[model samples]
Target: MSGPKYLGHLNINVRNVEISHEWYTDLLGLHTYDFIPGRAAFLSANVELSHEIALTQVAEGAPGLQPGQVGLGHFAWRVETLDDLKEFYQKLLDRDIKITPRDHGVSMGLYFQDPDGNGVEVYYERVRADWYTQENIFTNEKRPVGDFPGPWDELAAD
Candidate 1:
């Protein structure tokens, strides 16, 4: 019966991580608490989670994201539990919504496109203690979404 709680964070894809990091931090008055050198930075305005802004260097060879032509990579909302994720997944299917469920190493994510072809990600964060210890927190390892059998008998169209 649980559901998405609130806007967890935003993952912005930028061509230059260092410059964007500087831009965002200065513009927003955020402080960097953790980073993977030039690849990514988790910044904070001192939110409940480790960070509020997730900045990632654009993938090699990928064209720079521009306004209008740019989709906001993906925005995420957090569900309270794994059960909440499964229930929401089934509901999305019940309504015939197309969704791509993903396990983002740190969180369980359901990636899907909106009606206008914009990408969206609805996710359930793995309970911190369950996913990682304090010392080893963030990761960018890509993995396929978990294949959880739905409560509904019907399968969604890909």
Candidate 2:
């Protein structure tokens, strides 16, 4: 028998759908396909999909996921290029959002939390031809924040 072709979507609980809706749309550039005000909302990065993420509002004071929680750790999105990642990094810096950067040898990513404390990661992976080899395919390393190199310097000088 065949299994599922790909992971379809993720549904997460939030304190308020409207608030998390704004946060997801604004920070991660996800477009909302449907929203039900205070109750629930569905969003997606691809226009073709109905929704890649669905947010269901719980109580306003619902407890958040803790560090050692046995549930969802985080969800990640992959970008197309290093320049795109740098641009996003700048946006986070401009917004004063606390971020943790990670380097996985084949990719670099930023980790940050949403308004409801849901962890999210946005990253750019190196093209397979550029980083993949027969014997090795993975490496995990901590990257210092603000180390993304790009045209930010020129833009800053402008």
Candidate 3:
């Protein structure tokens, strides 16, 4: 069986490369692998990889995506455990970024947007048995998230 293994990288357009570069690096903990000032930047969590995300600068004052727009909805970054998710959740709060927390039965997710309004999600998956089963592969049930941090506490009632 020959098929693609995983997503190699992603490229997105931003209003300013320098701004978005700093934003992504600081927010996602990605380091600069390569950069072209005022034009583009390549960032990665793994130094081994050339880049996991590439940011290309667009003209200033360009309009951002509007509600109900038909386009790339969002991209996700997966964290390892509940603790990691909590740490990241704190980071988002420290940065004063708005968040939408969701419990997908098999995982917990924090959704937010970047400087240019690019949707991004950070999630922590539960054990494989919770999500890898045939019948329970994709679940939208609201499950209790014990020990949830901050806004995630609301999910406890579900």
Candidate 4:
């Protein structure tokens, strides 16, 4: 099945609304808008689009993201290119964001976290035709990543 024209936004419950608001704004290189002092806030990466992400403050002392727990697996961003992905990788590194890299055959990605330990992935797609499977869709192989620098180059290049 064909995917939609594009993904729009995500609504997430964060441990602290104020903190997550700052985190996303900084990560996306955009400012927070339509924000209430506490409770919920909206973020946009571009002016033309509506809020790309909506953050709601979870109750205080709530347990943070549980990796093995059944819930939202993760969210993602498709950068402009390999170089762009690398730039984000470097930015993340500079800010001490831990990255776990992977090669999905059709795409390369980095998995990391936000302040609340919510999993976030940043990835770049490689050649389409070469990675497409005989099943007439992109291969879903989750394997080690490719060469070139990244947060987990040592393991990914393998």
Which candidate tops lDDT? 3
Deviation (Å) of 20 in candidate 4: 0.8
* TM-score to native of every candidate shown: 0.44, 0.86, 0.85, 0.78
lDDT, candidate 1, at 127: 69
Q: Which stretches of candidate 3 lie over 4 Å from their true place?
A: 139-158
TM-score of 3: 0.85
RMSD of each: 13.4, 3.3, 4.2, 4.3
lDDT of 3 by residue, 1-158 (tens): 89999899999999999989999998899989889998999998889999989999999889999989999899998998887888888788878899988866567888999999999999998897766343534642444543333555443332
Better of 1 and 3 by lDDT: 3
Error of 1 at 35 (Å): 39
* Candidate 1 stretches greater than 4 Å from native: 1-71, 132-158
- As for TM-score, the candidate ahead, 3 or 4, is 3
lDDT of each: 0.64, 0.82, 0.83, 0.75
How much does candidate 1 score in TM-score?
0.44
Candidate 4 TM-score versus the reference: 0.78
Q: On residues 1-158, what C-alpha lDDT tens digit does candidate 4 reach at each position?
A: 98799778889888788888888888857557689757998887777876888898878788886658988888887776987777777787778787877766667887888888888888898777766463534444544345434445533343
lDDT of 1 by residue, 54-113 (tens): 878775555654447744676665677877777667667765668777654567777775
What TM-score should be assigned to candidate 2?
A: 0.86
Q: Distance (Å) between predicted and true CA of 117, model 4? A: 1.1
